[model samples]
Target: MATITSAGAGSGIDLESVISASVAAKKTQLQQPITTKKTNTQITLTGVGQLKSAISTFNTTLAKLSTAGAFNKRAINITQDSDDPILKISSNTDASNGQYNVTVNKLATTSKVEGTFASSTSSLITEDGTLTITAGDGNEFTVDVKKGDTLQQIRKRINNASDNFGLTANIVNTSDGKAKLVIDSGVTGAGNDLKISGSTTELKMFEADTSSATPVTGSSMSRTQQSTNAEIDVDGNILTSDTNTFKDKVQGLDITVLRVSDKDSDGNLKSNKVDITTDKSAIKTLVQEFVSAYNTLIDKSTELGKRNTIVGGESQDDGGALAGDSMPRSIRTLMANTVMEPNSEMTGINSIFQLGIKMDNDGKLSVDTDKFDDALDDNYEQVVALFSGENGVAGKLQTSLKEYTKTGGLISQRQDQLNSDLRDLSSREATAADQLEKYEANLRAQYGSLDTLLAQMQSSASYLSLLSTS
Candidate 1:
């Protein structure tokens, strides 16, 4: 209320108190309903937000269950008795459930050629010529050796060439006061072999010919190592690869040959068995996670629609902040329908119950572990179809939940409408506050004028009374 600077000072009447009380009464009448409506709107908005969050989380779990990798996973085991593993292996979900007898005969080797020199800094190449180098799949390029170039300088020139493919050149000390130009293929494999030919006889010593009848050893040159492919025998079927790592050898399998298995005294190859099987425990965990997420969403949604009895005999729905809203009821119906309905498109296991997932009396899911494990053991494909296909439980639930939780969807639209209402209410409240302020000012002005008139009248009455007494 606007205060009067000199209100009722001469009238002996407390008009300020009266005007303040009047303004207060009017303020309550104008503001109380708006306050109540805004409070209710905020509460409902919060409840709807929580429901949307729960549905979004539930949809994530549904996505996890719907993926092919989750249901079609396979586990692998290899014999651990061997000190050095013959090979390391991994498989995808598409891997077959079987055992493989793997015999690693030899690991792939990279081509390494060394060119010996009389001394590290001696100018060995007496002529200037181009050395054409071929590496890995006939990629031919050339490096020029300048006249009077030392072995170390020639090695540096080769190492710095950009077109050298995967060839590396180094000058290694052979411990006889002479350095050797060691050239190695960057990648391991016979296909990645490095070959060199020169235009001059002096540079011919740098040629890499590991398959010579006799070891190509000159006074200062030798072939230290030869390029070779990896060899493995799978149940009498020999498989060879240029690289150490082999992929798609078996469907969905990748094998990296770590080392060659030890041979017996009779030269018989040692073998190991790799067992691939369905991962039942992983499937169980995914199912449990889905159940837990579904239960939480259901419990929260149910609480939002429930009514509670007051402390005394009266009954009220004060417990549900979102009481009488259709969204909660719609959510419950959608989830229940999705779970109970049969997947007509699925041929074998068309319903969740076939996978040993059952809804209890409290509307929560419980899994029968024995039944689930048995289903996984016997009918794994059927179990997978029940939860993952087009008409699968997870697929249907994901589609349905997306309708409610996606942008511009039902829940999103409802929240957007509520936010709009809050914005409008804020504007209305501001306008009401301004109006009430102006109204209180008018009331104070009117009361202050009335008090001045009353005081003047009292002064006249007192003067008349004095005149009559005199």
Candidate 2:
């Protein structure tokens, strides 16, 4: 008789465990959404993008705070005194003669003259015979006088040479039918003393007739120095300097420096302040940028809350409010509270809301243009304090945001934890798979041996039954 006895199946090879393990691994991969290899890259990119956007918003706000018409502290302007008239000779006019002198009480430490002059004779005459004339001394005079020049020719010569000398020369005909040559010194100083001593006598008519038997008594022209630079009060302080660097003399102002004499291109003896007006357009642009950035953040938060992206969703797709949100509710809460809160350290600035900026229904920032302008007009310092003062909104926001994104911050710590978890999970999955595969192979061998034994027993039983029946 053939009997069937139970041989242990040895737990049936637990195929379900292998399948469950595979399913669990797939589920784990899906649940994590980001792998160890890609998590850093995605998070880094997202964090950088958010940081850049925040910086852009901050910059926009800062730009709005800067007033366009604020006077450039470096600017300066130099204007000549209107009350005190400056003496300038008309064209075609010359000094009483080729020899004329002027005197003034106040003297400019640095003085210069540039003009042209002509004389009847070519003989060079120094303004002060005692003072040696040197090139570029502002005192050297060039006399363009040709030989055999007439009285009228002498007048023309002085006019022609007016550029070389600061003085002018002209011949005035008296009622006695005699012409007297006159010279007028263009500048006032001891250096203005004119002397004519050369081989040419044509210019002698303009000199003092000291040799006449009867000494002609007239106001003997003498040279005197005078202050040529204008004085001005700057920042409640009295400062003196050359006209060229007058702008530098001022404490704070932007000025265009100009030369006093037309001959010297390098000489800057005057300065003109440039006109600066408030740039309303720039302010408007800044406001728009801020609004746009704020709106973008709000929109991004909304999208993240609705969708199950790594950055926030609910149920299977619901990453939960915090799960997939790019701009988390916590961050929004921080931003809102920081911008709205008042700081005890800041005296005038209480809140950004005081500056006429408010959030709309869409959770985007908006500015009341007129009210904002009024607030700015009222107290710009208070506005600055509100956003940028000690422990202020902007400062707090920056600190909080940086804490979340900076190295060793929340994001970095989370990433490190995730990476470690992934490593452990990967090792566990590999070990489970290896153990399962070995178990399956051993079960297959056992099943093959049992099948061989069962087949032999069946064959022997069948043969024995047939022989007995026969």
Top lDDT: which candidate number?
1
What does candidate 1's lDDT look like per residue over 1-470, in tens digits? 44676668869898878878887898798887887889889999999998988899898888888877567877888874557677888887668788988989899987777766778687877779987877677666788999998878878888787787767888878878777788886666776666677788877777665444243433234567777889888777898888887887777888888888767799987888889888888889878888899999989898886666577788765677677777887888889888999877766677888778888776889899999999889888888888774567888899998998899998889999999999988888888899899888888788888987999999999999999999
RMSD of every prediction: 4.9, 18.6
Residue 269 alpha-carbon offset, candidate 2, angstroms: 10
lDDT of each: 0.81, 0.45
Q: Over the stretch 64-149, how does candidate 2's per-residue lDDT look in tens digits?
A: 33333221111111233334422121111110112111111122332222212243234434332221112223645545545545
lDDT of 2 at 75: 15
Could you give me the TM-score of model 2 versus the true structure? 0.44
Total residue pair clashes for candidate 2: 53
- In candidate 2 the C-alpha lDDT for residue 361 amounts to 66
Angstrom error at residue 155, model 1: 8.6
Over 4 Å off, model 1: 1-12, 113-184, 195-223, 306-309, 313-321, 346-349, 458-470
